[model samples]
Target: MENAQTQLEINQCAGINLLAAKRKLVNVLEKIRHAYKSASPEFLTKLDVSQKAWEESLEADMEMKYPLEDKRLQYGSVYPMCASGFESRLVLARVEFLKEWLKGHQDGDICSGSIIHSYSIQRDCSNIGK
Candidate 1:
C-alpha cells in the first residue's frame, strides 16, 4: 500500500517531481512485469515511455483515454475520480498514466487500464529490471 499511498499523495497534491515520480512509475511497471512473469528490455523502454508520457500529461494537466466527444481527441479519461476538469485530469493521468506510452506499440502492453483495485499492491521493491 506504500506505492498506492504515495501515488495517492501525488494525485491529491501539487508537486512536480516528475523525474522521481517517473522513477516510481518505472518501479511499478517493473513490479507488474515481474509479478506477471513477463520481462523484456524492449517492453521496458515502451513501458518507460508510456509511464513518462502519462506523467507528462499529468504535469500538463491533460487527460488520456478512450477518445472522447468527436474532434478526434481525448483518450482514456481524467483523474481524481471526483470533480471534473483538472481534478479528473489528475486521476486519469495518474491511474491510467501508462496508456498513451503503450499506444505507440503493442508489445509492451502494461496494465489493462482497469479501475484501480485492491490487489494492485505488491511487496515494495526498488529495482524493476532493464
Candidate 2:
C-alpha cells in the first residue's frame, strides 16, 4: 500500500503567474464592458497581435524610461498601451506565462494513490493481453 502511494504525490503547484491570471481576469472583465470586444469574428483573425504588441511596447518602455537625449525622431510610449484589443491579449499572455510555469513544475505533480491505481490498471491490462 505504501509503495503504491509513492508515485501519485508527484505533482504540486510550485508557483504561478499571478500577473498573467490578473491580466486574463481583467481581460474577461473588460470584455464585459464592450460585450465581448475581442470576440468578434473580425478580431479573432488578428490572433495574438495584441499580446505581442504589449510585450514589445513594454520592452521599449524599459529601454526608454531612462534619460533620453534631446527630442528624438522616434515616437515611443513610456509604458504598455492598453487598447480595446488588449483584453484578449492580456488573457492569452497570462495563460501562456502560467503554462510556462506549469511546464517547469509539471514533474512536481504526483501522488501515491494515482501511482498505485495506474499500476493496478496496467497490471489488469497486461493480464488481459496475456
Which candidate should be chosen as best, given lDDT against the real structure? 1
Q: 1-130 in candidate 1: lDDT tens per residue?
A: 1343554564444333434454555555655555434334665566558667765866455434322444223322223322233434454456455433222223344664422222332322224353
Residue runs of model 1 more than 4 Å from their true location after superposition: 1-30, 36-38, 62-89, 96-130
Task: Give the clash total for candidate 2.
Answer: 16
Q: Against the true structure, whose TM-score is highest?
A: 1
The local distance difference test score of each candidate is 0.43, 0.37
Model 2 TM-score (2 dp): 0.25
Least accurate 10 contiguous residues by lDDT in model 1? 74-83
State each candidate's clash count: 14, 16
Instruction: Please write out the lDDT profile of model 2 over residues 40-112, one tens digit for every residue.
Output: 5544334346556666865565455433453232423311222212433544655564332122222344643
